[model samples]
Target: MAINSLKRLALLGSVAIGLALPARAQDSGPLLDLLVKKGIVNDQEAEDIRAALVKDFAANTSAGKLNLSPALTEFALSGDMRLREQFETQRTIAVPGTASVANERERVRLRFRLNGDLKLQSGWGAGFSLQTAQNADSANQTLDNIGTNYGIYLARAYVSYQPSLNWFFTGGKFKNPFFTTDLVWDADINPQGFAETHTTFLNGKDTFEVRAGQLVMKDNAEAIAAGAAPTTGVDAWLFDQQLVYTKWFGAENLSDVLFAPGFMFYNASTITSQVSGTNKEQAYNGSTKYLKIVTLPGEVNFANIYGTGTQLKTYWDFTYNTAANDRAHQSVANGGYGLPATTNKGAMSWLVGLGYGYGQGKNKGDYSLKADYRQTGISALDPNITDSDFAFNRLNQKGYKFSGSYNLTDFASLTVTYFITSRLNDSINTKAPALAADPTLSDLNSTNTLQVDLNVKF
Candidate 1:
């Protein structure tokens, strides 16, 4: 028998057993013996086939290798780990009804995440990620003397379909679809919903995209107890739509520039204080309800700036709360939880940021520096969804943030970040009375946070 034909037959047999070539060849010794006995092929030819299978396996097992099948066109795995030490401090205005006048906190936190991706033949794909954390806003687990075991959760699990090169749809818990800063949606928030994006290539150097998504923020089961429809209570939800445009300017010497501008409209369903429990709960959970928020986000980036293998980026984000009055109405209708009724008006918030060097470090000595300034009005943005690490996640606070990072190796890095909110809305009559006891925000004047992290990825 021809050696090539015998090799093909052996490969088929191995695939039937779901084993790769080299391992399959070794396990096929009995079949080869039978073939030799039947005079189908001599022992020498069988040995040669086995040797060729080994060579093929050796050639295939390289970096980025995948064990592919008819149904599984591609597969990949990746993950990261981080260790952090954080310190936070805040001072209050010392009103009579408050419980505490000052706050200080310190913690050591760690985070790890692992992800898997799969691509099918019919333009469909799925992804799953496991992350350490019990909270949606953070993947960090704090180390404590109690020897508390960390928790791992399903941070992301989504299925995607790409009907064409220009359109894509995804469902399940996935990354946020809107182009935004952490001002509204924290980087850690993976919204659970259906999301879609369509891209149009305007020209060789320009592109436009439309992104939309609807997220279910909360599902109240109060109806079950009240003997009503399942959707009786306000099913907290968010609707988002955005248009993004991008243009690439030809390189200027060693630097290439790109400018992107985007507009987003975010809407929330009924946010009633009746169901939102205490003052803290109302502030954090019900803040997004009954509001129309519009955002304009713009960015300019220069790659290889100064020819030092660096990139410079600047961003400006402007947000207007069209329903701030509505939120204020809800607040006043609820008796302002104890305060006066003078806080009823829509508000705005703006942020400007500058970044230097590679955004995410890649190699040893690689570094990044970033600074951002944020000014927020009382009713500006959704407080519940903002970055928790920023000023203890307070709204109506003005602050500056500074961050720097340096890579220790290709997959490991050290980073330091500091945030200072010098001004805050702490007037007793301006806030609900229930919040008067919470030292973290109520009666707050200013707060500061410092964090150091050692990050590793693969």
Candidate 2:
């Protein structure tokens, strides 16, 4: 009996050591302590086993070989890749002699992103990310160009300092810190500048938060030439502030509500145009003198309705540009739109959506369906930062969006989305004078878009 017990103890120790090889150094301590307490091994024997495990791990595993600094407490790597097939159709109105035209296009695109995060001592953290494309509103690369290799761009590089549990500060080109929808900002856009955030807990159950951002839009080195004298160029900026409150109710906090009210100020006097990596101008084709906006965004959630493992979600966003100036909408001869100033208020944008889901669509067997209605005015939101897929990123449009997603595995999912939209105002020109031959009119009347995507994450 003694010999058999010794053999079993030896086998158990070996199994434990093998299982702990991929785990962190501190993870083997509990198993070793248990072995010592159960009389399976002496203290010295447990120590010997631990030393052997560490040595073998360092010799075998790539992560174990990493010489991380002592001050670095944690590091993580994560990313996602997506393959997409997109289809689009646009219709043009007929004129006196010209027939109506419909243009259709189809393309396959791919997007890949990789992110690294490092957490240091004293509440400091840094993060960086790489993406496949250079567009601020998109990360997709069309699978063309004679099968040439694509270029990767630096998408996000930011450092954050959290002096306390309730306060945080970040600087550099970073992720959007505000709670918002694609109605006002694109999902892929990372704003460049600084942000401050604060949170207050109420009764340890409800919370209120404040978020502020000062983002640089453009930098001009030389003075801007106006009518007579050159005006000193002021670096254009977008300033944002928001207040969010979240409350929970009902048993086990099954019902939750959240509301965020925000304001934005865009200073774009010196921003004439922006040249992109493709040497194409991206935005600011039109004047952006007045773009102060007020926004209200909110959501409500009910968990485990009727004891089912599903959630019901309703969300909405509303924005109005208080500084939308009629003078900016004057005819092209006046350096504005082709329509009269009084006819183009262009001050409102809003969306309402509903979703039903088992999970957030990130786990195996998880599925979700969502539908929304949206309307955007020409001057209601920043055209350069809105969703690229909806209405081809054009303003003065209203549409219905439908999407569904199902996870095939914990790290893989399939999604399909459709957008059907039309012009909100048929009389005004949606394009800049440089883009349209008829500066006073636009030909495109309606658009339809479809996208199918397969995404994998790690």
Candidate 3:
């Protein structure tokens, strides 16, 4: 009986409240009055009017809907693509060069890149980039090959771990720590070896960076021969190391140019010469005091060029970067020659280079111009087939490039460039007459190559 009485009292109270409330609230009357009485909608109505949203919320609340979770955010993706073309011209007289000059050939290449950023609930985040080149990685040549197929160039692939400020480590292919232009390395199209970088600070608004790694080398036997030289090419091991340092030059972006120079140390096996077994090379056979009248006359040091030889090859190079507007060209001049630091009877050579650009000045003209040059260090050139001894000499190289660009539009442009080089004087070949006597064939040396190419990137 008490329970029934309580239920009736509750029903009567609900009925009394319903009767007292305005009937217009249940009808299609002004919704502002209900909000105004509940201290919501203001009189001037400056607040935004979300009609559908308020109606849905009201219906759900009336239906006894209790919200527990928050709404999900959206994931977005972005990418870009580009096309490129290249052409070359080679017109030269007969020269016994390493290979035939590649003729006038035209090719088109394609490139694409994609990026994804996953924003987690925590402040920490992760992302990756998938890139591709026109020359697909193939095991063999094919017909109708446009370029490398569209595949994961994997320019960078890594899971970032960031638990502090200005600190991160991504374990995978990444931008080389070396400071240089993309066109020189086209770092975007190909992935290099492993790399790492660390940044520390000085006073406020100041920081420093350090990077280092190794690259694949040792594909040249010239290096192996160098090491054996008191006798030849500096012998090098299979790989090369890289190191660089960068520091904040000044304060804001206007003064933010970085100064970075790098160095490397190689780990190579020493080379030595062996004089036993089949190597009866008569060249320096214990400095023959009594010359034999027979075949020994033609024997030279390299008669046993096959001997086991061991030696050390080492060098040091330093490069510097300055502000764009700063006058620094002369300091970066090319074509250098010098003797080895070590007294081991061998030689080491080095050179550095820089260039200037004008078409990219403040003028919004339709065309641009740039000039640049680079050089190789001094080294020995193979001349006489019978000269088994290594001679230290200056045989440096040089190259120059001229370029112009025409603006097609905001996102497109036409570029044309001419690259050329002057012939360098190698060691004087005294043995040419002896070898040229053969009426069947002859060998000659000359240097000249020209090229033209087109590039498009975004």
- Count clashes in each candidate, considering only residues at least 3 apart in sequence or on different chains: 0, 0, 23
Tell me the tens digit of each residue's lDDT in model 3 across 374-456.
Answer: 33222211011111101101123334555666555544556665555432323211123223321100111223332232333
True lDDT of residue 309, candidate 2: 68
Ranking by lDDT: 2, 1, 3
Instruction: Give per-model TM-scores.
Output: 0.79, 0.87, 0.44
313-335: candidate 1 lDDT, tens digit per residue: 88878888777676545532343
Q: Top model by lDDT, which number?
A: 2
Best by TM-score: 2
lDDT of 2: 0.78
User: For model 2, what is the error of residue 446's alpha carbon versus the real structure, in angstroms, after optimal superposition?
Assistant: 1.2
Clashes of 3: 23
Off by over 4 Å in 3: 1-79, 90-102, 115-153, 181-194, 214-257, 265-369, 378-397, 404-410, 422-458
lDDT of 2 by residue, 351-431 (tens): 999998887677899999999999987668776677877776777779999999999999999999999988787666544
Local distance difference test scores for all models: 0.70, 0.78, 0.32
Which model is ahead, 1 or 3, in terms of TM-score?
1
